[model samples]
Structures are given as C-alpha cells and as structure tokens.
Target: MIEYGFRLPSSHDNRPLKFEEFERHLDKTILVSATPGKYDYEKTDKKNIVEQVIRPTGLVDPIVEIQETKGQIDDLIKRLNVVIKNGHRGLITTLTKNSAEKLTEFLVEANFKVKYLHSDIDTLERIDILRDLRLGVIDVIVGINLLREGLDLPEVAFIGILDADKQGFLRSTTALIQTIGRAARNVEGYVVMYADKITDAMAAALSETERRRNIQIAHNLKHGITPQSIVKAVKDIAQHRSTKLKGGKKSDATKVPKEERLRLLAEMEAQMDLASQNFEFEKAAELRDEIERLQAEWGL
Candidate 1:
C-alpha cells in the first residue's frame, strides 16, 4: 500500500505533486521497466488503471447524527424514508457491494426510488443515475466504496451509514467523516449511523461534525444570511459541457499533430502559471492533467 507523502519538487516550489512531475516520473519509471527485448506494462499501448479510478474534488462536508445500534439501521431508514416520501432524497452507504445491493433491492421493493452503484454499473448508466437523482427522478442511491469523495449530490438531505463501528478503510474515521460530510452541503442535510458500540473512528467523526456545523452556523450568522439548502447551493458543483465539441475547435482531442500538441501544451502551462499566481491550486492541478493528456502520444 502506498501512503501518500508530500514531496517538494524544488526547494522554492511549494505545490504538491502536479501532472508534469508525476508524468515525467511515470515516463522515467517506464524507461526503467523496458529491456532490450520487447514488452512492458508501462510501455504497452494502454492507459493507466490508476487514472481510471475517479477522484472527486471539493472541501469536506457532512452533518451527522450518530445512534446506538439497537435496531438502529432500521430506525435510521425509517426516519430517512419519511424525508424521502415527503419528496426529499436520502443516501445510504454500506461498506461492501453485497450490502449495498441488498439494501438497494430492499428499498426499491418497498417502493422507494432507489438504486445501487458499484464498479459493476456501466459508466453511461452511472452518469445517468447521477443526473436523474439530482433532478428528483430517484430518491436514494445506495453504494459501497463508490460513494466516497468527488461524488456530490446536493439534494440528498440524509445519509445513513451502516456498521459504523466496523474497522477498516471502509469504516475508518476518515471514511465516516467523508461520508457524513456529504449531507453538510445542504441546509437541512444530516447523517445517521447505526452502531451498537462507538469506536475511536466514531468519536473522531462526531467531534469533526460538531466542529464543522458550528463553523458553518457561525459564518451564516455573522453574514446575516440563512444557511441554504444543499440543493440550492450545489449548482456550481459540475461545470459539464452541453454538447460534444467539434473536431476543428481548439479543445477537440482528435486529429492533432505534434506541432498542435506542443502549442496546446504551452497554452495549458500558461493557465497553470496563472492559477499558481492566483493561489488556486486545484484549478492549477486540473490544467496540469489537461497539459499531460494533450502532450502524451498514447493520450494516457
């Protein structure tokens, strides 16, 4: 397992690893893996498996309410169902695919608008599911590992976590905090965890929740503005395009030559530089990836 560590590329450079350094390192690693003979996983005409994994971006958000586990999951669902039946949506996250599927089936058969997503769901279906949920076409989405990070839906008013005290990455303090924080994006959002005995992770999650809630409330009060619903505030989350770009346009990916690639690379570098100057690290990081994809022969 790789424990992520911060490495300064140069003494004067302060950004965490960006696409250029990461890709340059990738190229160096590929060079090392190749012998005089023929094939290598890194050198093959293939894309990286790690790049296929999704990473959603945003600040941490969740407002949680923990309950002791005497029929706690059922009770949590009942409360959440009331909110959903009344026209709001809820989310439930389990630690395993089996659990997510079972719960999704149970909820759907019980007449709630629900679906399950894991690595199994087709990419196209997943995109539709996300959009439908936002539009109120679905009331709940239950998932195992897929629900964490980068996956945002502001209309969800409740999040229920089952087996919160179970230990693992799926049940860790960071995981619970990230899951529950999904609800914090909405004004009336909240989380409920069904756990018989609270663990260290549970304790940490609760403390973090209280801290974030107080801070958001304080900010709202000081500004003399009411805290808004998650739905109302999430419009800026996705900056997706309406239609596919035509090939002749500058941003189109197909049919570009080496000259065009370098030109695009320089253009993206300027954006990266501007972002660094403005202290917008996330934007800078995105542009870095764009530059890499634009420059890569394999478009990896």
Candidate 2:
C-alpha cells in the first residue's frame, strides 16, 4: 500500500520506495500501477490481498455510479442531481478531448451548469474555469488528460469516468487511478464508470482500487480515531535540482520503441568505433558503456 501518488515504475526498479513505510507496499508492480513493488503479476499473491484488514476513515464509502454513451447522459444527470441536492460539485473524465467536448456541450444544452478543461484551453481560461467551478458557477467539469492528475476538488462529490473500458495509455490503470483520486477529496464522494466490457486494464485498475481502499480502512481501524482524507503529495521532479534534465535536444519519439531502440544502439556502436579510430577514447568509452547498459536492460 504505497501512499496514493503519481508514480511510474522504471525498468530496473531496485531502488527503495521513499514513501512512508507504514503504507503497505505491493507484491507486484507494472509500469504505472497504483499498487506497489517492482515485480509483475506472476510474482504477486492474490491470497495476500484477501487477508488485508481494513480501518475506517471518517469519509463514507462513496456510491459508485455509471454512465456510458451520449444517450446515457441522462444517467449522469441523475447522478449529478443527487450530488447537487447534497450541495456537492462533480468532475467528469473522458477518453479524449473530442469526447470531453461533446459531453460538455451536451451537459450545457441540457441546462446543467458545466465547463470543460483540456489541453486545447488556454492557461487563463483554465484558471478561470477552475475558479468558476470552485465558486459554484459550474456544477460539473469535463476533462481529458489534464484533470486526471494534480486536481483536488473537495466539493466534488461525484467523479464520473465516461469510458470505463477503452484501452490505451491514457485509459490504462494509472490514468484511471488519478481520475478516481479526484473524488477522494470529499468525505462523501462517489465514482461512476461507464463501459460494456471490463478490460484487463480495468481489471488492473479495480484491483489497485480495492488494494488501496483496504489499506486505508485497516489503518483507521487500528488507530481507534477516525482518519481524515490522506493525500499523497506527488513528487514534483522540478523540486529536486538533480532531477532536471540537462540541456539536450528533445526527441520527438516518445517511447524508445523496440525497433528504434535497437537502431539507436547500432548507431551508437558504429559511432563508438569511429570515435576510437579518431583517438577519442573518452567518447568511445562513454558510448561503449551506454551500449552495454542497454544490452543488460534488454537481458540480451
């Protein structure tokens, strides 16, 4: 049970977690799981999860809701109506900016006070949108990639995930964890997921949710006193001077796709050979070390 935070496991995950030790660590972890540890699923024990004891936080177990298509917007409306009656605000996440826009448009036309936040919106507008949401001018907000992380809306009693089964990096376990986290701010927050199939990604997402929820509950049980909402302050790499990237050209290619990673390795080896011929031992040695490390990472 690692504290709730934004973490992406790296290739050689040998480093010790720096988070609070009391938060139970996970048995297996993948690239971006809300769970803990460095191993993958095979190494994890399902029985260990069953044995997990729970403690109560003052917050209630939020009612889970679900809403799917453009036609199912009414389901969302009913959910929202329940929250509004309780004087709660709401947040909604979509798979893409286009989807978010359509939902926002539909919600507004329905005469429900709403707004949207996505990459397309300018910074000032984002600030204004957030302000309006906080002030109660906008009862609901729709977002794609932006609001999933670093968003804390205490009044948001409802957090709706518009597409529960679309599978991709943005729809993966990590993103779903963040979207769900938005509702963790309120004591009575609820979450809704709308989809036809439960994807492997969704399976992973749900597993992590149950894992963390169980941990938090157990912690409260032992303490005797009710626990308040515990937020994991996310690591801001900008804070640590050493974490900043040194000056270099940015690569357009996001991941080192296997094909490209191999090509780059070959190119580096050739360049290293050339450097050795030119008596550039320093650069040659550096490239040699780089190639060796990459080979080890691939277990080749």
Candidate 3:
C-alpha cells in the first residue's frame, strides 16, 4: 500500500524512489491519500478516481479561518484555554522542530500543560506523549509535520497553524489540508491559519475544505444525523514493556546471562506480535528495532 505517497521520498534514508519502481513490481496497485500527488493522477484514469468526502461517522470537515499573525501566540493561548475548559485538547503546528519546542516551552510558562513532538523524539516516548494528551494529562501539543496524518486524537478540537502564509512543503495545499483534518474527528472541530496574507496553497486548501464541509453538511442534514466525536480506547503499550534505561542504569538485557537474554528477546518478540495485532504499528516498529539491537549486542 502506497499510503501517504507525499512523504514516500523521505520514507527511507531521505532518498527519492521513482514511482516506476513500484509500478514494475505490482500488477495492481492502490494509491491511498486524501491529497493524492501528481504521480497518482497520472497512473489512474479520471473515471477510476473515487472520492470519500463524507465520513462514515458523519463528521464534517473543520471550519477554516485565517487570522493575522500579529500576537498569534496570545490568540492561541486564549483559544486553547477555552478548549481546555471544555475538556478537549489543541494542536499547534510550527514551521520547524526548533519553533515547535520553543512554542511548547512558552505555553508551559503560561501554565498550559503542553509538550512537543518531532523526529528527534524516541518512538516509544512519542506513544506515551500521545496517550497523555488523550487522557487529559496535557492540554496542548506543539508539533511539526508529525501531527498531520495517521493520528486519531478525537480530543483535539482546535488546531492552530502558525506562519501559514509562507509557501513551502509544510505550508503546501496538501500539507495544510492534512493538518486541518486533525480536528475533523470532533464535532466542535475548528482550524485557525495564522497568516497575514493568503498564499495560493492556503486558498486551495480553504476552498477544498469548504467544498468537503458542504458535502458533509448536506449529507448529515438529509440523514438527520448529528456528528459525534470518535471514542477510542487508549492502549498503553509502554506499560507492558519499557525499552528505556532507567536513571542511567544499565539495561537488564545487557547485564543478564545469555540464557536470560534469550528469554528477554522471546518476551519482546511476543510483545511485538501483540502490538502489531492491536494495530499499534509504531510501537511494533520500535520493538522490532530494539529486538534487532539486542540480538546484535548479545550475539543471540
């Protein structure tokens, strides 16, 4: 499955792979994404294109609004306060990892429970951070591109896109639409683009969102349906098996005898299987990497 084909180039070692490479290998292929790229369009006929504008849950797209960048942080704080008071969470996206962390720090100083997520964070820790947000342990999460796709946080009602006028990969139409979609899981979903001027990407994203929203609204009205926020049971994978070395202490896997190390590996393999079965792909990937590392270290 070529899911999130936009990021396929950076998916492995930052090297871009030509679409033909996959085309040669498979007789039939399905490219899935909300915003399919040019390659996807070229490969598939216009008649074959399928659109799923209305969600199965009847949730409509979030409302998109552009706000002046002046004092954007202050405005975000005020908005987040209201969302938090209503027992929901917020997401803030920045242009870079440094900006995300800095914004997270500023929010913390303002007494908002917050954290930042980016490529630099460990995979397992990232899972815990998301769980904390879902459990209301944190009110806001500042992130870069990591907050876009594959995240199902129904608690997030508000999304603040900072510096949205700047046109680049992160601010492109596809990126903006995906980021704005983060709030669509909630009935009160809303998006604020903090931009002084609207870019071409911003205009397209806004227009597309409005179109989808209208379709959804029409469908819901016809069916007499009210959108409800998705309720997902938060599963704690880290609680079952933690890979972190505690308090600068050596790992048990390293200090144990060869037989004990083998046993640990077996246990980790079992946990990885469970994580995969539970649809925790990120956690399963982390466990697989850790297992490889231990196998090489212990010569098991």
Best by lDDT: 3
Would you list the rank order by TM-score, best first?
3, 1, 2
- Model 1: per-residue lDDT, tens digit, 103-213? 888787778888786676643355557667877888888887755665557777788888888999888877777777667566666778887888998998788667765
Write down the TM-score of every candidate. 0.60, 0.56, 0.76
Error of 2 at 245 (Å): 33
Error of 1 at 230 (Å): 4.2
Better of 2 and 3 by TM-score: 3
Candidate 3 C-alpha error for residue 144, in Å: 1.5
Off by over 4 Å in 1: 1-63, 230-242, 245-300
For 52-120, candidate 3 gives per-residue lDDT tens digits of 888878899999988899989899999999999999999999998788888988999999999897766
The TM-score of predicted model 1 comes to 0.60
Local distance difference test scores for all models: 0.64, 0.66, 0.83
Number of clashing pairs, model 1? 7
RMSD value for candidate 3 = 9.9
Candidate achieving higher TM-score, 1 or 2 = 1
